[model samples]
Each structure stands twice: as C-alpha cells, then as structure tokens.
Target chain A: MTDDTDDIKGTPALDPVISDSVELRLARQIRELDREMMPERDLWTAIERNIADYPQRKPFNLQGDWMPYGVAASLIIAIAALLVNVVGLEQRNSTLLAADYAIDSIDSGYVNVRNPMVDQFRETNKNLDQATLDDLYRNIEIMAQARKDIEMQVRANPENTKLVEMLMRVHERELELLKQDYSQPGRSL
Target chain B: MNRALKATLSGVLLAFVWAMPCYAAVDSGDLAGKRVDLSEAAKPDGFVKISIVRGDLIVEGWDKDEVSLVGTLDEKTEQFIFDVSGRDTRIIVKIPSNNTSWCCNEGSNLRIMVPKGSQVDVATVSTEVRLTDIRGGLDMSGVSGDVRIQKVSERLRVRNVSGEITVHDVDAYARIKTVSGEIDARSIKGGGAFHTVSGEIVLRDVTDEIDVESVSGDIEVIGRNISLARGHSVSGDIDLEIELIDDALVEFDSVSGSVRLRLDGKLNHKFDLETGSGSIRNRITDDKPKKSKYIRDEQLRFTVGEGDGQVNVSTRSGDISVSK
Candidate 1:
C-alpha cells in the first residue's frame, strides 16, 4: 500500500486552470521571495512514515509558506459573495467551524413565512375540479419535497452560498403560491 | 307457483335494470349545449371581463368599437351573464360550483371579438384562453388550462396553476407565472418576468430585461439585446445566450443545476462566478477560476474589457460554463 500510494496522483481538475487575479498576485509575491534558509531540524523520513498510515488523504498541491495568506484572501472573497445573497435569511456566524455539524445554524434561523392560505388550500377548496385540484396538491407536495431535499443539500454543503440562496428562493415561491386563490382569477394581476 | 304472475314480475325487473344506465348517462354526459351570441357597443380603450369554468376561448380584437361574444356553453351551465355598462363589458358563464371531473366535456367554445384597444381580463378554472391581436393589455388567470396569446402591445399579465403559457409578439411589459407548466414565449419587445415551478422556460429575442425563476425546470434564453437578467432555480439548469447592452446586470443562482452563459458582442462586465462541489469552466476571458484549498469550491473574479456592469453566477453541486 505504501509503495502504491507513494506517488500521490492528482485527478484531472474539472475547473478551468486556477489563475485568477489573487492567484496571480500571490504568484508574483512568491517569485520575489529569496530561497529560504535551512531549518534547524528536518524530519522528512518520519513524515513519510506517518503518511504511509493514511494513504487515502491527499495533500493539497500548494507550495511556499505564503500559501496561507492566499487561502485567507480566497476565503474572504467567498464570504463576501455569500453575504451578497442571504444576509437577511442567514444567521451570521463569526467563525467557520469544523465539518462535524450535520446542518448549518442558518437552517434554524430560517423560517418560511408561509402563505396564510396554504393551510386553507390544503384543507378546503373542494369546489375545484378533480384534475386541477390533484395537480395543485401534487405541486404542493412537489414544492414541499423540493424544500426538504434542498435543506438536506444545505446540510451536506454548509459552505455552499448558492444552496442557501436556493433554499430562500424556494421559500419565496411558497409565499407567492400561498397568496393565491387558485379557484379565482386575478382581475388585476 | 303462479306462472303468469312470476313471468310478468321477471319482465318488469329486466326492464328496470336496462333503463338504469340510460338515466345515468343522461345525468352525466348527454347534455345539450346552450348557445350564446351577443354583441354590444363599447369604447376602443375600454375594459372587458370574462369568466368561464372550462373550455376553449378564442378571443380577438377588431377595429370596430363593439364587443361581440358568440359561444356554446355547457348544458349544465346555470347562468349566462353578458352585460355591458358604459365602456365596460362582462361575459360570465356560471355552472354548479361543485362539480366532478366528468361534469363538463369540451366545455364552452367562445369566440369573442373586442375593440382594438380594450383592456381585457379573463378568469377560468380549466379553460384554454387564446387571445390574439389585442392592442391593449391583457390580464388573465386560470387553473389547469393552457394559455396561448399573440400580438399584444401593452402590459400583459398571466397566471396559471398547471397549464402551459405561450406568448408571441408582445411589445410591452409582461409578467407570466405558472406552476407545473412550461412557459414559451418569443419576440417580446419589453421587459419580461416569467416564473414557474417544475416547468421549463424558454425565451427568444426578448429585449428590455428578463427575469426567470423555476424549480426542477430548465431555462433556456436566447436574447438579441438584453440589459438586465436575473434567473434562479433549484435543480434546474439555466442556459443563456445573450447580447448585452453597455450597462448589464446579470445574476444567476442554482442548486444542483448547471448554468451555461454564452456571450456575444463587445464585453464590458465584471464576472463573479463560483461553484461548490462543482467546477467552473471559463472560456470567454483569460481569467481562470481559483480553487479553494479547503473545500470543493472554485471562484472566478475578473473584469472583461472596461467592466461597466456586473455578472454573477453561482451554483452548488452544479457546473458553471461560460463561453464566448
């Protein structure tokens, strides 16, 4: 296993080559640095032995000690992108936690301000023809299921801003649907 | 046993059994259609209202200052109300409010001709409303009925529960919404907003602005000259092939759905694209996506040309494809 995993292979990246402005800036900064002085001690063989135990974990293909600053800048940009979308619906978290939590704190703070007529439509409104009524119910169920499935996806990818935005959009759809009496047409829509 | 009496009783029983199905048929299906034909004078820029249960409505606009309604209502229809007051006209066909699926078949077939500039409003349960050559505005809503309309030159608003809506040749602001029904429109010469759930949306050559939202439905837009666009979906893919103006604001968001943006003409927008658990493939500009060392997310932030406008696209578990 150690011999097979010694040369950690890199999978073909699905994205375009990572050469954005920040990366270019960081690359320029890296080029300006001089060769680092030798450390007091080096434990390359011990690190290799420890890596043999966990052959599944692949190290990030990053070079130089300045990589941490680059990562921080990227994280800042990502968070800014997220804040542009779900500021009202999302609960603000000061720090990013470990990946151990199954669901995000935003899920608890997010409440779907349902349409007041949703319960009425689910319970009453028998005057509608069967086909239309059935379609309505099926759609309601579909929307409910869609909401659930999206919440599950949010739980899985807590750092995904698009998923959170998608969840809020589903809630907005629910609100729009609730404000309607499907049996009647809007004279002034 | 009395043989004559027993024979007579058996014949009566058989006759009663045979007649039961005929009575049931008469109660349900065999209904005569009630005909309605009426014409009233009205203003050119007046108001017209129509209501029906279910059927095909063929409504058009004429140059004359009159509203003519000709149709056959269901025999089970309780009332046919056609009234014209001043410049307003109302045509309503009423039936028993509580009805089963087998209540009406091929419902009312109405052909209405209104004035050229009449703002018409229609409501129905399961009726396919078709409007054509109406120079004014149209506001209509229904449930489970497909809508087909054309040649409107004003604000057009349509809402449906589970029916497909198709619009052709509109020259004003339009807002069309549906649930579980596909929306297909073309040649819109103004700002347009279309929304649906579990239905695909397609638009072509719509100019001023475009806003679309969907769930579990794909959105494909090919516009000639677009200034602003906003599209959001969950589990629905979005494909936009557009030519933007100088100041364009394009934003797209999705979860578990891919977004493909193909641009044409001179570029002057900043691109802020990201994807989680997915990859961003940028082919339009020299700026490439930057991958995060922590998670499976990539971000591409760059300016194309002078960057006069903004273009943001994000997806979770979905790919982002940008091409020129």
Candidate 2:
C-alpha cells in the first residue's frame, strides 16, 4: 500500500535550474556567513523541538540566549520604527490639513472680489460727477447691483418671482432717475 | 449651327418677352408726372364718407369738383375704381370688393382733397391713417393700424385695437380708445377722454378734461389745462404736469405703481396724497407742515393762487412724487 501511494522515485533527482535558483544558492550563502552570526529560523526551530520532547510541559529553567537577544532586538527596532513613522505621518497630515484650510479661505475671498454687480457699479461711478449727477448715478448703481444679486439668489430658488419683480422695479426707477438727470442744468454728457 | 449659339438665341427671346409688360405698366400707371388735374369741385353740405380697408389715408380740404385718388396698383386684376355719388350735400367714395385680392400688397396711400368743413368717417384694417388740416368731425376705427390726426376741428372719436394713437393739434373734443397699444396726444384745444388697456397713455399740451385708464402701462401727462382730470392704472406710473385753470378736481390712483405730479409752483390748491410704505417727494417746496402718522400723514393741504383747485392722489405699494 505504501509503494502504491508513492508518486515519485525513491532517489532525490532534481532540476539543476531550480536547485541553483533556490536551494544551492541559499545554502551556499548561509555557509559563507560567520558562525556567531547564525540565521534565527534554524535556532528557533531546534529549541521548539527539544521543549516538545518532555512528557509534561514545564517552564525551562535555563536562559535561552538566542531567544532573549532576538526578542530584545526586534522589540527595540520595532519601537524605534513606530515612533519615527508616527511622528512623520502626523506632520504630513497636519501640513495637508493647513493647506486645505488656506485654499478654502482664498476661494471665499475671490468670490467676494468678483461679485458682478459691485464691479459694474465701480465702472459706472468712475464716469459720474456727484455734484451734477445728484443721487442719480449712485441710485442706478445700487439698483443694478441689487438686481444682479437677486438674480443670483433666484438661481438657487427659482420659484421666487416676487423678489425678481422688485428688482425689475428698481431697474426701472434707475432709468427714470437717469432720464430726469439728463434734463438738469450744469450736467455733462 | 452650333449648340452654344442655339442656346443663346433661346435665352434672348425669353428675356425680351418677359420684360415688355413690366415696362408698359410703369408708363401707363405713372401718376406723379401725368397731368390728371381736377377742376374746382364744390361739396356745399360739407360732408364726405371715406371707405378704406388697407391704405394710408391723407385728407386735406381743397376747393375742387373731383376728389383726386392717386395710387399705384400692382395687380391689374384689382382696379383702382372710385364711384363718387350724391349731389352737393354729400359725396361717398366706394370701391367694389367683388374682384380678386385688390389689396395693393405693397399697400396703398391716399391723399384726398375734400371741401372745407367736411365730415370724414374712415374704416381701415392694416394701414396708417393720417388726417391733417380738416375742419370737420372725424369718426375712425380700425384693427391693427395706427391713426394719427393733426390739426382737426369739430368732435373726434377714434377706436383702434393693437395700434398706436397719436393726435396732435386737436382743436375740438376728442375721445380715443385702444387695446394693448400706446396713446400720445398733444396740443389739444379741447378736453378728451383717452383710454387703453395694457398700454401706455401719454398726453402733452392738453387744454381739456381727460379721463385716462390703463391696465399695465404708464399714464404720463404734461402741460395739462383742465378743470377735472383723473387717471388710473393697475401696475403702472401716473405722472401729471398740471397748469390747472379754474377750480379743478384731480384724482390719480394706482394699484401697484408710482404717482408723480409736476405742478406749477405758483398755484394755490389743497392736495391729499396717500401711499403704502413708499416714499413721497414733494419738489414743490411749499411752506406746509409735514406730519407723520399711520400709513397716511404725508398730506399737503395748502393754497396756491387763491386755492381754487383740489388734488387727490392714492397708491398701493408705490411712491408718490410731487415736483415743481
């Protein structure tokens, strides 16, 4: 039954390519290493096998030198790496958060500066002479600005027609004021 | 002998045949240079009936026997025929409508010369009616056409729909009405009632009583010399420039529109103006007390020029401005 279950020959015949790629290269590299600096996996495996031979498991009285050294080294290296990574990650995250806050503030500031009505008012005011024009130009400017602002508000709530009509009246009043101002004396073109 | 020469010959024949009738119509239908003079025609009754459908009617008084109807008709099928009937009392110009669509689609314009003090009744559809220098009463009505009368005597009544009405130099009483159009009449020697719905009414240089009402258009009057004036609007402004004569009662009201009164500062009158939360600007600058109250109190009851005229104004959701 054992012979029938065997799927391979009793001799260990292997491919030279696979042996050189994996087993031979790893074994040769381990042999070249210094004796005091042995690989940790072989030592750990031997200690586990010896401990398991006891009938009832008892705590080992002898100090395992390799175990303590390996544990202490790994613990120290991990703690140091963790501290470094935590500090680096916190710094990067805070910097990103501050940049996002600054960008948001700048975006709001730009919106205030480019308000369409205010810009048109300023352009109209430059050509106005207050003493001669009376409150005509200023009223017109304010009315135009109010209309634009109301239109912008309606973009969000489109059913608000009353506000839109009020703005239209303001625009009409501005035109009336302009026409009345044209008939005044000492008024320039 | 060649194909190109044969094609050129056919093209020449076609051009010559089509151009002959067009050139012949211009010679026969030329009215301006031709001397079709009318002898002195007399209408002793001083009455005329003008029947028009689609043409500009320009009428003036003339001392002649024949009423000259000069027009250039595009279609030979539609005759420019006018049958003048009645003896000396009355004359009627009628053109039969049984023929094809005689509407000179470029449209037609009339320059009729009636006798002095002649009455005119014109009915039109889609053409401008301009009557000037007539010493008679006018009854005009139309659909989709403008009526402009300048320097006319006797009573005037005009009814139009969907067209502008402009009457200048009206020496008698005038009553004009329109729907969805503008009314601008000026320099009236008598009072008139002008009404429009959904249209603006502007009256200037008026010397008579006026009753104007609009649904959604402004009512503006400048230089009015009337004993009583009233204007109403649904959603429009009421502007009045008054130089009131005698004791006048002026009432101006608007539902949701402004009221502006530009009156002569040298007059003496008591005025009452009311508005709902809108501002009141009194440019008259009279020596009157200014009081504040609940929704009302900005009233100026003052006297100017013996305090003969009484002015009242009211509005809702609009301002009242009184300027000198």
- Candidate 1 Cα errors over 4 Å, as ranges: A1-119, A122-124, A153-189, B1-32, B101-104
Q: Over 4 Å off in model 2, which ranges?
A: A1-189, B1-40, B73-81, B87-104, B285-306
Give the share of true interchain contacts found in each model: 0.50, 0.00
Q: Number of clashing residue pairs in every model?
A: 0, 10
Instruction: Give per-model TM-scores.
Output: 0.70, 0.51
lDDT, candidates in the order shown: 0.79, 0.60
| Model 1 lDDT per residue over A48-142, tens place | 99889878755566665568888899999888877854662345332223322434444444333353456666544567677877877777777
Model 1: per-residue Cα lDDT at residue A113: 39
lDDT minimum window of 10 residues, candidate 1 chain B: B23-32
The candidate that achieves the highest DockQ relative to the unseen native structure: 1
> Using alpha carbons, what is the TM-score of model 2?
0.51
Name the weakest run of 10 consecutive residues (lDDT summed) in model 2 chain B.
Answer: B90-99
Q: What is the TM-score of chain A alone in each candidate?
A: 0.40, 0.28
For model 1, state the Cα shift of residue B25 in Å: 30
Interface RMSD of each: 2.2, 21.6
Task: Single out the weakest 10-residue window by summed lDDT for candidate 2 chain A.
Answer: A180-189
**Candidate 1 colliding pairs:** none
